[model samples]
Target: MSDLPLRSQLAVALGRTASRMSRLAGRGDGSVIGGKIGLKLDPELLTRLSADRKLVLVSATNGKTTTTRLIASAMSGLGEVATNAFGANMPTGHVSALAAAPGARYGVLECDEKYVPLVLRETGANVVLLMNLSRDQMDRAGEIWQLAGKWRKALEGVDTHVVANCDDPLVTWGASTAKRVTWVAVGQHWREDSWCCPECGGPLDREASHWACRQCPFARPKPDWILHGDRVTAPGGRTYDLDLQLPGRANRSNGAMSLAVVSLFGIAPEQALPLLGRVASVAGRYTTVQHEGRDIRLLLAKNPAGWLEAFDVLEPAPGPVALSINAQGPDGRDTSWLWDVDYRVLKGRPVWATGERRLDLAARLEAAEVDFRVVDDIEQAVMAVPPGKLDVIANYTAFQTIRTRYGRAL
Candidate 1:
């Protein structure tokens, strides 16, 4: 039982009641509102809820939600593990999850990068997962290096054992000063943010697998866990061939990092492999939805790095694809990063663009000489495609909107 003050316990009860009310009213997912109310009544809701639990905190610029789902699913074999499976990574989300699952002795949280330190401090998490960091939500996130600096300071003197990606310079620098670290050589495909040293603004030298600053001491740490092709080599020479429903090299990388964490908990990679592989979609990502006679698959990519991975999976599809772009609050106000993606790859493919900023995407596709048409309604644009398995991609808010509409139909 929690040793929290009586006042704090009352606050938690009040917050859970609010969550129920929100859900009943059809306002939205009750997680956010519940968290807000809990924290309002008792600012220490995170600390109280996280008490006496084996906390595993996961944070990164991309893939945190999917990685968290993979980790949580793998942990399910252990027992009832509390997690915010809906992709809410803030303090309130953590509070809501813990409050809902009071019986859970184990907690796995996907934390936002900006709030990682606060969550770490509050929960006193034993293990932290560090994935590669890249440019995301440029207006709110500012520069990527600044976020890395925040991570670096947060890890300093912290007692948690860090599982970090050694292949990415930003991640390396952030996890460098941690009390203890387990480096994993999960490859990084995005290098634009790490072109120069985060420690010292010097030119970085790159080799076949790792990178290092030419003039400074900051260099990539050799990974204790390494991914070679489809196989992952863990400590003590144990190897497991990654078999995941989630496609692409990125998910494989995420699985490798998760395996490294699982090993630390006395669970073998072989035993956890099947559990992680069963996670086909985190929330609505990569979920198949039948809408208006067209079988549409939902794909979400928030940034350039994410877009690169999504394109790799979408390229082989035999039908025309639809893309929705929006600059809403959840999707970030800035959409200039659209220019950085290699849209030329879609040169010969027929593209249907629709969203608040479809014109922006149209401009990019037109400049690349890609054959495309813009439709105002997303559902109609998707349905207008030749009847078959339709491929659809959208930014965060735009994706959520379509997922809500057709997800109900399913």
Candidate 2:
């Protein structure tokens, strides 16, 4: 930045001051406003900051934060790496992150799907990780396929190498035109959104593990990397067992993709596995907090797919689980996605629904024939757990609320 003009440097200085003021004011994480001010002053702030860094961009509907953390952890072996660990994934967040870690040699950024093109173009990232695409925040994000189409258009003729999930047809179509791609079969369970070919608008012929378009040339490419359960097989038949603290098959897939992305940086899975395992919690997800004198493990469930994964993690635990839902800005205004989830799995278990949308969740539980009680207060919900450890799952806002109530920094 010393080579930059005086006005650009002043913009950066002002942005940093704004970031400090935002933290002092307790407004939020301060990433958005800081980057906003910087970009407002110098519109090309991201491009300027990321000029000489080796960048790896991670984008997905789910597991992006975890995957970004995993990649950032592994990249530490290479050099100083910059990332937005707080889940601010838009342009503002990217600008703020680059400014915060100005000396970092490498940047592993978790990019929002809509802003991936701009970030990629500006940063000139060498590797891009394309994770699964799903229906998330529909009112704000629009359709999943529409975003994928933008990705395809944005990536055209770019020289960056892509590591994409071959199991997802949407991802496959998005990365099809990349100059260089390393396909990874990371195992996707959500196929509801990718039932047809993005190329020809035809039905895809599906199998147990792979799919192909019946009417078009586009299909699941041959994967150079594969994940079998918790073990990931590299290109050379070398396998690394991912014994992650983060539970569930979804995390296993995230680990696989993270391994694939880092491998492009010449960091093998054997060296990256231990680093990835150390991530116990990401922004309060999959963590236990002592709040109101009960041991409450926090799980975040925002949509049907996320709820399904959260239920799988909660299934093996004890009784009287707590669930909180909210229809806030980040969680999306639509709660209709609840009906799409298979809540019958909790039929015999006792559940306590709590949050801004607690009644909506209670009504959904009733319709699903599940036994549940409604308690809107977190303290009461924690006390409602019978003698054992309390397990809690909440949507976006509710999870952050509980985390803040417990005095954890956002």
Candidate 3:
């Protein structure tokens, strides 16, 4: 602490104190609040704390938190890794994470899509991971293509190495301007957001896993890394099995991206794969908690793209699915995104809708011809099902509420 500037040192100390107080008061982790107070005290604290540390900034619409957790876990093999393990992905969270772990030699930060450019510029991160781009909290984030334009401008002529997903045309367009980039072919299933080219506003032609602009020269970049099913094929044709504890192909894609990022820091995939597998749950995304003698798994799906991915990880039929949604400040004050999700997939499954915005979800499910019962309370929704394993898929605040009520396991 003494090695830092006097103001930064003071900022870190005060930030830690504030975080402790917040925890003592049972108000929350204080990650954002602490960083906010610290930044107020020392405006340059993020730069000072990020200096001399090998930092990796991860940004995406859906997998930012999971990918950040995977990278941080793998980086921990080298030494202490400072990361925002929670879903605090703004500048305040970045400042709080750096301040909390001053002695850590490495930092892996989950950055919000909107704050990626600012965090990238401030941290001067060694590697910036850009995953898929989709409509998430459209009220606050505007449009996905506009966000991609901002990323393209910010990464233009940058020295940092970029690890990007090539399957999503939007991500390809965003990271194409970077000087050094390792493209990973992590498949994108959500196509509603990117039907046209971000460069020329032309219709994009999709063929299997490849996409090309019908009007412009922009196209999918040849990937240096490819994720197929549970296996990740890296450069030199070396294939590694991604035996991750985290479910679904989305997490495997996240693992592939993490492997690519850590490899730049001299961490071999063989040594890092196990570390990635150790992350069973990230910020309660895939946590299973016992409530009312019934085991319920919690999965967070905040937007259309996220819900699409979450559907892939859901348990098989007969295992009732409880869905919860909220339009809280953290979750964006908009419930119209519900219509974007195709709920017909849950037609045959036993489903229950419960949350602050359950009516909206119920209406969407009805429109899709999916039968669901609206239960006001989550526990009641779970009780409506048979005693066994139940999967609870929820948005931001609803997920937190259920996790808290059932006792946060992660």
- Candidate number of the best lDDT: 3
In model 3, what is the error at residue 379, expressed in angstroms?
1.5
Worst 10 contiguous positions by lDDT, candidate 1: 311-320
- True lDDT of residue 239, candidate 2: 82
In order, the Cα lDDT scores of the candidates are: 0.87, 0.86, 0.90
TM-score of 1: 0.97
* lDDT of candidate 1 over 262-364, digit per residue (tens): 7788888888899988998888888888766788888889899998888877847346788899999888998899998888777666789999999999999
TM-scores of the candidates in the order shown:
0.97, 0.96, 0.98
How many pairs of residues collide in model 3?
0
Whole-model lDDT, candidate 3? 0.90
Best by TM-score: 3
lDDT-based ranking: 3, 1, 2
lDDT of 2 by residue, 1-410 (tens): 68666877887888889989999998877899999999999998888988888988999988888899989998899878989988889888988888888788899899998898888888899899998898889998999889999899888899999999999999989988888889999887777788888898999998889788899888788899999988989998888788998899899999899889888788987889999999888888887777556677888888777877788788463356888898999999998888888788877677888899888888889999988888868778787766566778888899998888875632
Residue 178 lDDT in model 3? 95
lDDT of 1: 0.87
> Model 3, which residues run further than 4 Å from truth?
none
